[model samples]
Target chain A: MRYLTHKLIAFLIALMLAPVMLAPSWAQTPTLNIDVNVGIREPVPFAVPIFIAENNGAQAVATEISRVIASDLISTGLFREIPAAAHISGVSDFNAPVQFADWRAINAQALIIGAVSTSGGQLTVKFRLFDVFAQAPMGDGIQFTGTEEGWRRIAHKVADTVYSRLTGEAGYFDSKVVFVSETGPKGDRRKRLAVMDHDGASLSFLTEDNAIVQSPRFSPNNREILYTSYESGQPRVVLMDIFTLQKRDFGDLQGMSFAPRFSPDGTRVVLSISNGSNTDIYAIDLRSGARTQLTSGPAIDTAPSFSPDGTQIVFESDRSGSQQIYVMSANGGEAKRISFGDGRYGTPVWSPRGDMIAFTKILGGQFHIGIMRTDGSNEKLLTRSFLDEGPTWSPNGRVLMFFRETPGADGAPQIYAVDISGRNLRMVNTPSFASDPAWSGLLQ
Target chain B: MRQLSKAAALAALLITAACSNTGGLFGGNGDGTDVNGLNGGPIDESSIAYFQQTIGDTVLFQVDQHTLTPEAIAILNQQAAWLNANPTATVLIEGHADEQGTRDYNTALGGRRANAVSAYLVSQGVADNRIQIISYGKERPLAVCSSETCWSQNRRAVTIVTSGPGV
Candidate 1:
């Protein structure tokens, strides 16, 4: 019966959109067309009431799930949630139709209704989104089932669905971040590896503070992490399984190695190795333990990040007498410098969208987090601070998270996230001082 | 006159060192002797302590500069003479930078600075085998404050005797 209802709703939505889909481009053209190149600055007004509890002992989970979904949407700075008290009608039945007139009267552009049930130690959630302006359901309802402990992930999935459907872009809510958690004082700082949800929840420490760790990066497969550890009294790249916590050092290539980033395929890693004289970039095949020197020069070339397509690598080098961003073939060749700005550029991370590169810029004693086109045009600075570096792109490439260090004896570093449009800059709440955040691909 | 204040500062440092459980500010490995030359006895001129206290262990650089100045060269010349005399001691040259640059570039600049000092010591007859170098970048700062005074002090390369013969 539920499957038939879903099919009917889907067909109805298709029928409703047929007219707009069939309209010719020339016929729909207007004399005054507004080019909305910029993003939507004003938050869209939406409503998410408390989900209905369909089974005994499911009311608490239903309420908490609804709250999580609402918070996730609001945190993106793109949605404004209308309080439940503001609604003229309450949704008490899972099968009842939405009162679109009541929602529209309250100025709610979008409405979400959901129900939760539990049976045989499994939790199930069903949700439907409605377009109040059109006085109709936007699409067919969907359901998710999982273990009770995985309720937050299910909530994130629902939020991701709503965000994607409304914005026409992929949602980054269902992602994870790996970073270096720091504690103790400035002189004797201790660091460990930590992973957390994208909204700074569900944090789990991956390593102890016995050894110094830096620059933890997630593999494209999202099952392992690559980081630099000083366990042997010298920095070396270490790869560890995110689930098993088993780690192995890169086979003895000599010298100190740091700044390891996985290739797009997750089969290899590119890192910086210093040989007492100069530091250069090297790519290592993780399985075969074979190494290839990508950059061979007298200058320092480090912080290598591969493009999304895996055909090229973007890195920072001092070949031009100062630090600048450069790009070269994945197999290694003469790197063409891409950044010609007045200051220095380092830690250039290619966006997942493959159109821009986010980098840390240093100029006039201040560090700025900025983005530029791949060919080094359309530069825009998103943040400026005493010390801000190490930018990691969100899975959707619409946001960036970086660490900012305050200046003083008691100064501490904290992680912060900013939209690519330079609006909605917010600090990510961490247990303690944190830096070097790396966002994981969407979880399976 | 400057020598008198240097002695006074050494005395003050030793007085504080006596109160702390850890070794002096530099934390030399449980050595009872004053490494900062506070006792003023017949000091071992060939000792790393003497080289650090008298010839100066660190040379400061300008912002974003890896080149050594004439003053830095004079100090390195003295360091080379001391290292040549203490031939058995292996030295580790640690390069540092102020917190004004990105971590990666500052790391490379720190490497360049350490290399510059190492190359100068080799040019002055110090064997390359006796010296090793590392760049801490801006990770480890000698001065925690953010002013120019602190930044100047943090942007330095210090030569330390890591192992081998001791004075």
Candidate 2:
């Protein structure tokens, strides 16, 4: 009877502590903790090691991918990267067992490691994440394969998987960017449309060097681009195929057409047309060459972008005297002015989720990239610089890609990306000048 | 050939006369035959003459729009007639925009304006291959002002004569 009583008492004690023990292991972070929810606390602390590839193995992919992963995670501002120099143990092998005690000694609550290999003209990468306290993987390892030059994209996919596993949110690393490549002096500049991976790799030009091209936006699938070019020597919207580089003018608008943005459905493009000295918003079907006038009147109705549902559009207009953002139905109707702030706003691009509108704000002689709700409330500026404009969203709507121009002694322009929270502002490395970035949707 | 010699002699006489008549009509700033002072203010007669000869009859735009006015069409018709006379020369229709919009959009708007003119030129019997369109959105402006008037003048499509290839 005494033995039976002792065993029952032990069972009762464990039952009482079961709820406490069942909580998620990721709930605690001594270095940092990001709630990422309404009324949440500080950011989470995580350590990402440079993925180790074998000596003759995926050396090129291993280093490139680790950097992209670091960049993507650091840009979120919800995680702090513990320096690699501070690591207690170096990750020297891909399948080498992790020492949880060593990671804990460095106070890393979460850890990441990856490995790369190449065979048969294909590159394969596999990565794993761990919860040090839980003494297990936070999730299963991910494996991907691509070309050697496409190593950055593979890294981005890995980062995306890791990010989604931890935050329950979609990752945007596996994406691409289309932007304007600028050269020559400011007065007589030569601009061309260029596309690259999201981390600035595999850059290739789409237009010839003769005529200037700008504001290149990718179609939903990222297989085509819609931009304005002076190839015909007039500012008209033109569509270019990514693979063949074949281009066709949008339509015979009989006037200037510009600020072309593909609709959310990707079948139509909304742009501005200057008919008889009056510029208004117009939508053109890429398939049928059908045209629909959206904004009527002479108030510089340009930069038309569709909402996520394709029901409404956000655009810039000087109808309210100074340039400001306005919202109207996809079919041109009475537009309600949404900008009531202290500055002028233009290039109002709708967020992918239909929640916010990103714009370029100029106030007090300063240029800023800002965002506000569709109703034009809760306006917040993400970046303030001498000149920063042309904001594009990541596939997941968590980050933005834009360009910054510093009137340097050398006269150079640079491209940059930042989280919507105004954190992790970093320069995207490129050999030449880059501007007017348009982020593409997540690659399949 | 006789007309060329007569014009050269007339130009020489005018230069000497103008040099002697300095500080009177041409005035105190050494602004002789050169209409350099014309750049600082409103369109002067000498500057208008220069514009008429060099820029010809050009149509301007309003901010981001690229529609031509009746007056602009009339000017374009004149340009088309001139091109019809000079069939051997290829013309580049250059588009421009004001500084009111984003540079990228403005660049596009400029292209649109240039294309509009190119299409019109083609419709007027100017061979499609003879005309090339290019947009310079808000990059090069004739006037530097944020006002409506300046913007109106900045949005334009000017016909530029292209010397033969490699020239």
Candidate 3:
């Protein structure tokens, strides 16, 4: 009986020790901590097989959707799509599990499988992403429903999801670019406001070529545009609804106003107006029409762009006897010069990320599109040409679009885009001569 | 036939004398003969054509330099005299830049150049009210080539007589 009593006490002690060991040791012990330390410099190998069609009528749409998604991801310079001919397996069923071994054999690190279905004019796209190397799905599968007419946008949405899941950042594929479309010779150039999908698709003119339009900027909400119109014989700032195509002029100010940009809140517009003698920066309330002059010097102060927070303004000024960049509070106050580089800087657009500013720099008889930190350090030039000006930032602050004018009389200006990392320089295709590109925020 | 030839020769001599007195073939001054009417002693050549052709309407500037050169000053002197002669004519000074600078800065530089011309014209006895300034920046170029020759001609301020005899 004494021996049994001892054994019971010992069993109780062992149970208490087991709890302690389980709580501390497992919690502290490190498991296989896999970290993707090296950045994805080379494009990640991905496979986007043709999406399966639930019905016979959905086959064409499925093919087009898969093609668009693959193109979108490929254009980012971060993902490469594996061709169908090289694929060892095909995704025949939407609900079936991904064959990670098949994708791995083809050396694809990521795999995308999708299916398309149409019912009563409604198109549905369902997609799943898998990390082939990990041999499991990366994220939960998603499905999007839209009309037949919006199939491209639906494709872009799937691409955006796959991109965000892989890169851990928001995607910019589902955006639009508004720019000035040009035609005719260099001397008598005709320009009109044009808008297109971010990939240069669905191009449509927003305005006629009756008047000279320039410096188009998208409002934060992407519902309206603020641009300079030479409709009244002098440059005037006007706001127009992007969808309705209706416009309202800023209340009659006495002088010529141009380079209008919306405040972060979209309640105000900051622009440059020439008071017959000198040009200065001014901010006007959209609702009240009250004017506030931000700079009052005898020199020219123009191209006023507000910081992301709307608390500060960065602009180009010649107050220092040469053209340079200056930053000041949103409200009128003493401005501090930010650029001290060798070149003259203008068109200073603050990045949406609030970390850098993109600008056009002129030096040694060449124009360069460059970026610098907000504090004016680490200046990097992305392009060089006869003339490259009017830089506009991408919605995610990862890319910049500007106009490049070729050399000589027939020098047509074309829009070009470059990543902030100084790679993926590409010419944005347009029907004719185009310039002054402005990127809008992601559509709601 | 000899008499007719003599008459033609005399007419030619009169035309040559008239052209020379007006300051060469492409001169700003009108011919000494007041053929176009107006009670004329010398026939005031204060028209816009005279200003553009003879007095010089544009003055070129160095790259990014707004300071007027001596040669530019010489041209402006004649422009000032012509402007002072015609009081009713108001001029628009359009400043332009070469395609070598940023659009915004080039615009600002163009503005400074226009302002400089306006100030100099005012200094040269031309009324300030008679001159208005605009900066086309680099939008309009007289020379389309990319060489220094074309760029020099592009970086200039052109005084356009908007209203008056020129109009």
> By TM-score, who's the top model here?
1
Q: Indicate the TM-score of model 2.
A: 0.73
Clashes of 2: 14
Tell me how each candidate scores on DockQ against the true complex.
0.25, 0.14, 0.18
Model 2 DockQ (Cα-based): 0.14
Could you tell me how far off, in angstroms, the CA of residue A290 lies in candidate 1 after the best superposition? Answer: 1.6
Better of 1 and 3 by lDDT: 1
Cα lDDT tens digits, model 2, B10-79, are 5434543444455445454564434332233323322223333433646776654567777788878877
RMSD of each: 8.9, 13.8, 15.9
What CAPRI class is candidate 1?
acceptable
**Worst ten in a row by lDDT for model 1 chain A:** A14-23
Q: Candidates sorted by TM-score, descending order?
A: 1, 3, 2
Instruction: Chain A only: give the TM-score of model 3.
Output: 0.90
Ranking of all predicted structures according to DockQ, beginning with the best and ending with the worst: 1, 3, 2
Backbone clashes, each candidate = 0, 14, 0
lDDT of each: 0.81, 0.71, 0.79
Q: Which residue pairs overlap in candidate 3's backbone?
A: none
